[model samples]
Target: MPRNTLVNTGLNLLGLDYKPLTVTIAAMEADTHFGFEQVSPNEKEGRVMAVFSSVADKYDVMNDLMSGGMHRLWKFRMRQCSAVRQNHVVLDVAAGSGDIALGHLRKMGDTGRVILSDLNGPMLHEGARRMLDAGYLPGRADCIQADGSCLPFADAIMDCVSIAFGIRNFVAIEAGLAEFYRVLKPGGQFICLEFSRPVLPFLGVIYDTYSFHMIPQIGEWVTGDRDSYQYLVESIRRFPDQKRFSHLITQAGFDLVRHENMTGGIVALHRGYKL
Candidate 1:
């Protein structure tokens, strides 16, 4: 039997009647996770891109539905912990719909700038639109399509770097953290908001039930894309737990690293400095 390495994708997306050509070469030299299933590194990015492309339009709505609007509260707390000041330059990686960047902007008091970077063009475009709609000046918010593991900016340029619920999906999370460390100025801050293990036993049971069963079903009902939502839920499970992830951040040269669990540890906010 021969492995079929070509895939055809045609969707009328963005109201543009667009169709995309995706050629995936499955190289098995190294394997990674596309949800729970193992896939080659070459195949993971294309699959992840497909998932985001399918859900880009309904991403925000589905997030609200899935979290019952608690995601907003979590993000507010993250912004408060950011300690953003005037004249700062913050990079929000995997900045879906620009939530973190927008929150940072509000904290910056119209004085600082932000870059919303995501690998998926459709997702990044959605973020850019939200930034413009929020009346953030073009000079203040710029959107770039770039991988989190391999940023395009010069070293020591950013005063703060952040990623929310995004690093888990990175094919090489350690590389992405190293990139964050490399790009931050001395004493700069790094913040990450991500899904983590629930603290109490009962809460963990309930969360797993909802995450594995309810999320994908609701996602299909809302976005007509069940597989992407399924992958999203599994990715959360695959992510490192709060304490282990905090140690990984410290290894990336961030000092004074700490994490605060929110919503009973279903989500955690980790903060550290490049000092």
Candidate 2:
């Protein structure tokens, strides 16, 4: 890596401005995973953003195509577990297209609010637009361009925190989890709906075959971006499995963390409570 690249990374890692933090540069330059490829932590964010930006308009369509529309059902299960009540505040991180956010808005009653956040501006804009199209009031849902690793919100304020199909893209998974924990009110819920390793060996075989072969091809035909889909499929494999992820939630200071696997474990909904 270039010396200047390392300097910039150090600044980001330390949450500082342009001042060079040379002391942390060596430690911060360790390569992180971007899909199956190793990339600088700084580079991985841009790469992931590029991938989502390329597919922002087509993200919903591709989700339906790849999951056979089961993504909706999985998200429904996520909402069921979310258990958001009237007057509660929800912060949905990396909230791509706002499907999960819209679901909450409908159920959270008129007084309740949801904040939809995404790192990619295009993805955030798409999500905000869809929420409006669904008849949700602008005040009922707020859209912010934010990063999961370091949210701009105050501590212990959100009644529920969520991320759907987006956590695996984080360059610092643990950091993001800590931020979730930090932002949630005591007794708040943390709901994560994500793709996971298949439990059935045969299902794994079929899934791998389809994901490695067909998903990228489908992406190319639909969004004219095969490489982005290729990286997304690889990212699911790189993410920690159900048990490991549950442990991570626990380590983030949550209690009663558990996961329910859907579609033979191809998707998992992990719920935790901040007590």
Candidate 3:
């Protein structure tokens, strides 16, 4: 089917009556290929949350298998840079499966607190259940369902905000970053770990090939879902490069913005401060 027809069909299914002419035209242009137009930040986040929710049961397993257990190391490095303290309160946005929040708890002990928030209830439910199974009571780590672009927290309430492999999925990265700035205290830190374009030419080609082919196969084998993995690879390709994303962070009122390329830039850890 033509792109406009497909978009109209989707809108019809959603029961949206008014169609912006520009959006229809844009959809047609984007329909020259199989990929859809970039969704608004809110829509993007919602779509991703739904996708993760659908795959929640297999999410952590897929991550470990897909990344060869390197995702844990990357997350650990992000936590180290976080420099969390026992007296600090951290917010983990889009905290699927609660790996980062759990790690924070382990490092900060009972005196610290971490809130795991995600737009998807299923992902949050799984994370909450896992925390309970591990003997961490609900109060020790709170799980709230919320959109990252509009966090439900008081201004300057958190000492640190972190999102792992999550920000790229935000419908509006700028809006999400602004929300991060708003929720963090002065001198608070924001850290994000995401897939980035590899800087090394040969390595980049190799990584791209592997991600496009092997990752989806693993997804199909493990979760019986290859399309979601394909979407993941496409989203990474569509994401803004490291430097551009850093500029967005700065524009969102963060200071001292910097990013470190990891694994030859296949992934990057971005850190900025609310100053």
Model 1: which residue pairs collide?
A: none
Off by over 4 Å in 1: 1-29
The ten-residue window of minimal lDDT in model 1 covers: 5-14
> For residues 1-275, what per-residue lDDT tens digits would candidate 1 score against the true structure?
11111111111110111112121122223588888999877678789889999999998998899999999999999998996788898889999788999999989986888888888877877888988798874668777667777676667878999999999988788778988998898989999999998997699989999989999999889988899999999999999999999999999999999999999999999999998
Off by over 4 Å in 2: 1-29
- Candidate 1 RMSD computed on C-alpha atoms after optimal superposition onto the true structure: 8.0
Clashes of each: 0, 0, 2
* Winner by TM-score between candidate 2 and candidate 1: 2
Which model, 1 or 3, shows the larger lDDT?
A: 1
For residues 1-275, what per-residue lDDT tens digits would candidate 2 score against the true structure? 22111100111211222223342333346788888888898888789989999999999999999889999999998888887889888889988899999889878877887878787887888887887787664567777666777676667788999999989998778778887998888999999999998998799999999999999999999999999999999999999999999999999889999999999999999999989
Global fold similarity of model 2 (TM-score): 0.89
lDDT (10s digit) by residue, model 3, range 1-275: 11111200111211222233343233223212111445553355446766786789999889999999999889989888886889788889888889998888888876877778887777877888877887664556777676677665667778899999987776556768987998898999999999988998799889978998999899999998888888888888888899999999999998999999989999999999998
Clashing pairs in model 3, backbone N/Cα/C closer than 3 A: 41-171, 41-172
